[model samples]
Target: MNSTSFDLDPSYHILVTGGAGFIGSNLCEFLLNNGNSVTCLDNFATGKRENIAPLSSNSRFSLIEGDIRDLDTCQQACKDVDYVLHQAALGSVPRSINDPITSNDVNVSGFLNMLVAARDAKVKRFVYAASSSTYGDSKNMPKIEDIIGKPLSPYAITKYVNELYADIFNNTYGLETVGLRYFNVFGRKQDPNGAYAAVIPKFVLQLMEHTSPVINGDGSFSRDFTYIDNVIQMNIKAIVTDNKEAVNTVYNVAFGERTDLNQLVALLKEFLSEFDAKIADVNAKYGPTRQGDVPHSLASIDKAKKLLGYDPQFDIQKGLKQAVRWYWENLK
Candidate 1:
């Protein structure tokens, strides 16, 4: 919620890897605004310099142009840092399917590098960006942390591996770790132009241009679309929580609700229509279901609420309104 609500000290030095990406950049901004010394490490592979350009001017913000795949760079970034928010990873199942090697190189190997570096540096805590894709083929509704099905994609495997590694590091090396398995997160600065671009921004951009956005399935597929601020809240909670039981564990970082693709498109159009009524007429085209895609996903946030006191402030409609307005002003 607010800076005063967090347990983080103003003088603490924090390292946010992938700090130029959408979520990481947002985290950096939030932390720096709260009077924390924030260092950003990014390779610019999928991260954008424009995201952190404004933050660079802040006296409390520093940037390290490096890759997480390199242990030396990870160590350098972790140096003197009080906390490590490891958000760097190759996202998207299709992208990982196309290039599993590269994805493994970054998501798996790179993650290990960060863990080792954090262990060596003895950072106060290691908070990382896990994925909801870790649920894989589970038919379970309102997915729980303790019950997960087998991973279906290379991306999922990599993220699951991250949790396993985090557990080992905490037990063997005495490193405190918390993993937040983020759902489909969306918000400002999310790139709409890319093959692997997320659904919300991409569809918003398409609607803004009065073009048809393609749906991967018949539009029944649902996901717990989390807002960026909610994700930021989870990261803050993970780093600031004093509960011993909360540490060395994973929590589903989501809004704890599901929105089908059909509803998502309708909502986007409804919100975007306020800017340009023509967008309200734009419709989405359906296509065959995507590989490595699950039909529906929901999260049980009881654990986060009970352990970390996580309170997500934005829901789909509210978050979509803000996101649509942001896209209109910035990208339209």
Candidate 2:
């Protein structure tokens, strides 16, 4: 669990903006497990304390309940932190469609606040979560980081704006920053009960409950689903990496492969059936295509590999197996 022996210092203080959220909580555990000091700031909006329950006793970890939309809260979280991992945002295309203003306020304005606060705090580096949705209308086979299309949803616009503002901050204020454009991330502690829950978790939960999961559009719609552990590895490399070329650049965080919904469901059913045979017979219901949903997405990881020595340890099959196992043991 210690990275100190691997030449990483043990006393680095890292601040995670949405530390109680699924991805944020995972990063917190990774940082703390590697012998780094961590401060988690969350408003409990979408994030939950249960996500961080396992780390409650870690002396190297601290928690602050606050909103990033408030500049003061952002400032407080940045104080004395060596690195900033900004993960707080109201995410979900449908949620954004229902309430665009709030999504922009949290995802865009709050992101700007974090950037300014990190700049003022003089943190070593600021790494924020961007999204694959930034590649909105592009029809390219493998989505490269440099090439992007117009946003299809308000949520996508907000995330794309984060990268723009991060670039501006770096150029205008001299604050070093990196934006990680994460593809569909799935893993343990991902909440599956919400109306705006991501597909992987929601489908897993539905299968567990003996309910049919809805597949919007034809089963041909595809995505490059990344694993939580790979994401944690990217964040760590972003903060601690000595590669100057990697800093201040946006990298696509994905497995570099795509899987269609039908394939995804088949894989999920295959894995879950090991726990309960009845699930293998459970078929998904097809519905009208979702609003603001893209038909396909696949990231080209060549840029990340060339710049950051990026390497993904889990592909969709490997990740799905681990994720389904977690849901079976924890959820049911």
Candidate 3:
């Protein structure tokens, strides 16, 4: 992935809380490549060690095997860190519904612990992985950051609570914070296995295996399907920006356009067919819509563009092509 030219100094020490997971691992790799000292903290609950294995060779990259649910572990991870990118949260609405208590314990309570630790450590900035699910139940076509509706699931509730706590920390404790509300982010390193695997990776794997991928709804349901590179740019921008007005706010990180599920599958098949034409023949099966899933999700990235100078390089087509190539080379 190409690096964005941000103002982050190479000498800064950074901590990535879920640095073994898909997005977190990618962030750690980017920071380390830019000549920064990176500390990764992960308990390996949902994160896989193999994702971050290559990073071990970098002398500036260190791993702290711990959980955020433990306040002491969070404190240790924040020690001597200049910035904290908090990405250690239990994702997936279905998983949250199945186990709300565990989800709360990790996403909500653990997030609070990280906030407390960062506040006490006096980190220069706290940038976290907030979700688009916080826009729940609202019928707005292009979701703006300020307006939100009732949360549809346990996962949404936890993410929304994160925003509230971040706000409180900034107001009451004076800790700098920025929340990036990411839309359906996908790219390389994202796991394609397990019940909660995201649709992009899961479908790519099924098609490569010559199996029909299932669509949760009539296939018209759409999303803003952001690429991982765009998300990385936002995180880096969040940490390095010197504009005081941008520090305490949440911004939407997305491609600024929507793509429906049917269109998404067609694009995937087209991209994968370059390697094996048989992938085009594999069809998608229809199923009942998932509970708590919104019919459509689109983000207005005007805030991020104006405040943080975010210029997303990859649209869905560009991102999907790269993602398909990675899965073809890695999975096959």
Candidate achieving the largest lDDT: 3
- Candidate 2 vs candidate 3, TM-score winner: 3
Candidate 2 TM-score to native: 0.97
Q: Model 1: per-residue lDDT, tens digit, 1-332?
A: 47777767888899999999999999999999899999999999999999999998899998999999989999999999999999999899999999999999999999999999999999999999999999998988899999999999999999999999999999999999999999999999999999999999999999999999999989999999999999998999898888899999999999999999999999999999999999889989999999999889999999999999999999999899988898899995
Worst 10 residues of 1 by lDDT: 1-10
Q: What is the lDDT of residue 286 in candidate 3?
A: 99
lDDT of 3 by residue, 55-76 (tens): 9999999999999999999999
- Could you tell me the lDDT of residue 224 within candidate 2? 94
Sequence-dependent TM-score of model 3: 0.99
The candidate 3 region of ten consecutive residues with least summed lDDT is 1-10
Q: Give the Å shift of residue 153 in candidate 2.
A: 0.4
Off by over 4 Å in 1: none
Model 2: how far is 84 from its true place, Å? 0.3
Candidate 1 residue pairs that clash? none
Ranking by lDDT: 3, 1, 2
Q: How much lDDT does each candidate structure score?
A: 0.94, 0.91, 0.96
